[model samples]
Target: MAKWTTENPAFVDTWFSLFRLGQTKKQFNAADTIKMSELTFFNPLSSKDNLKIEATLIADTIDKVFSSWGAKLENSISRNTAINDMIQILLDEDKTIKDLAEKNDENYFFTNEIKLENES
Candidate 1:
């Protein structure tokens, strides 16, 4: 799984809480709190959209953090390429498995259980 090391747990918790409240209460304003938390976390350094300025700052902060850890964005992209390649291979294999299941009258299993079994 891809990891984001600089993610703030408290911020995430609050974001989720706001999202859940918005869903349960059907209040559109609850999204404002979530958006604010996102802006606080992803403040970009430069952005054309004033609404996204905070997010730009946060992105700049994350870039700096990654640089300090010796993992720049380019290196992260390279790593992600490898991960995507692996995912594509797995998806192809899953298609093959589904074909076999269809042929055998077992139907195609698309659940986590099947994926975990295939992995093992």
Candidate 2:
């Protein structure tokens, strides 16, 4: 079977998630994945559109890692800028999106059991 692609994006519940972090080692660790998965900052179920991501960019959020990405999907320019700005986060020795999300989330959104896809 083919892997999931952006053209046919997967819709995920805000309560649980499994996403890969860039530049990070994919070696699974139970506690670390839990911390990353629990972050409300990256929750895909946002009702917010044209989001100003900076307000949420504090201690434990993806925006903190890419502070230049202040605007959201407002326009092609903004989208391109934000996407380009994201490249900075991949720089070595810089704090990562994984670092911020794993620090602690506000937990304002959903909270429920998150299990590995392989689990029965």
Candidate 3:
């Protein structure tokens, strides 16, 4: 994606909001995907447009990652730029996770459900 700029003010605003939502939510659902679909340049579900496809992927990812894990900062850029930055961040995170998995067994990070002992 091209660098995000202020030229697309609407996209910028929407992304900013989605980014913030990631911080407060434990997980996003299909409803969130529908909401972010509003950012698409065309009808994402029905249209085969490239912009629409990109928009759908972005929305799906936002929902999947819970809004960039609330890592959005006050950076000035256009929609494309924002997308680029987000992809970069996610890639970086993936790399770290992969490294950790390689260091330990595949289930290294997968543990059983948390158990809380009685405080009383």
Candidate 4:
């Protein structure tokens, strides 16, 4: 099994720390800002199934870590864009859809009338 081992785990931790700072009116550091920006640009692709699974697991891990602090893993685009470009790419690239459905429960249609709601 693949694992997520970052060069700087503190960088990932600092990104989550921003949510707390935002809630408490504390100032976020410059490094935190840069790390968050770097994380936003990740777009991995692979031909091997194992690599794809590993990548999806990593993305899911990041999404979960941020979500614990009330931050959502949204696309790097304005909400008013013509298409949800990042989400489409994620789906096409075999990234897990469960995270997206969990975050956007209101938008997921399970049946003609019943939308699958996330209990989270």
TM-score of 4: 0.27
lDDT digits (tens) for residues 1-120 of candidate 1? 212111422222223333443322323323322223232222344343542443233333433333353432232344344333323322231222122112211211223334556899
Q: Evaluated with TM-score, which candidate comes out highest?
A: 4
- lDDT for each candidate structure: 0.30, 0.28, 0.33, 0.33
Model 2, 15-114: lDDT tens digits are 1122332323333333232332343343445434312252223222333323332212322334334333432322212333343232212221112212
Write down the worst ten-residue block by lDDT for model 3: 107-116
Q: Give RMSD (Å) of candidate 1 vs. truth.
A: 16.2
Q: How many clashes does the backbone of model 1 have? A: 12
Please give the ranking of all candidate structures by TM-score, highest first, separated by commas: 4, 1, 2, 3
lDDT of 2: 0.28
- Report the lDDT tens digits of candidate 3 across residue range 1-120: 322333332233334444464421312222222322232232434534554455446534543442343323223544454455443332332222122212222111111111112332
Superior by lDDT: candidate 2 or candidate 3: 3
Instruction: Score every model by TM-score.
Output: 0.25, 0.24, 0.22, 0.27
RMSD to native for every prediction?
16.2, 15.7, 15.6, 14.7
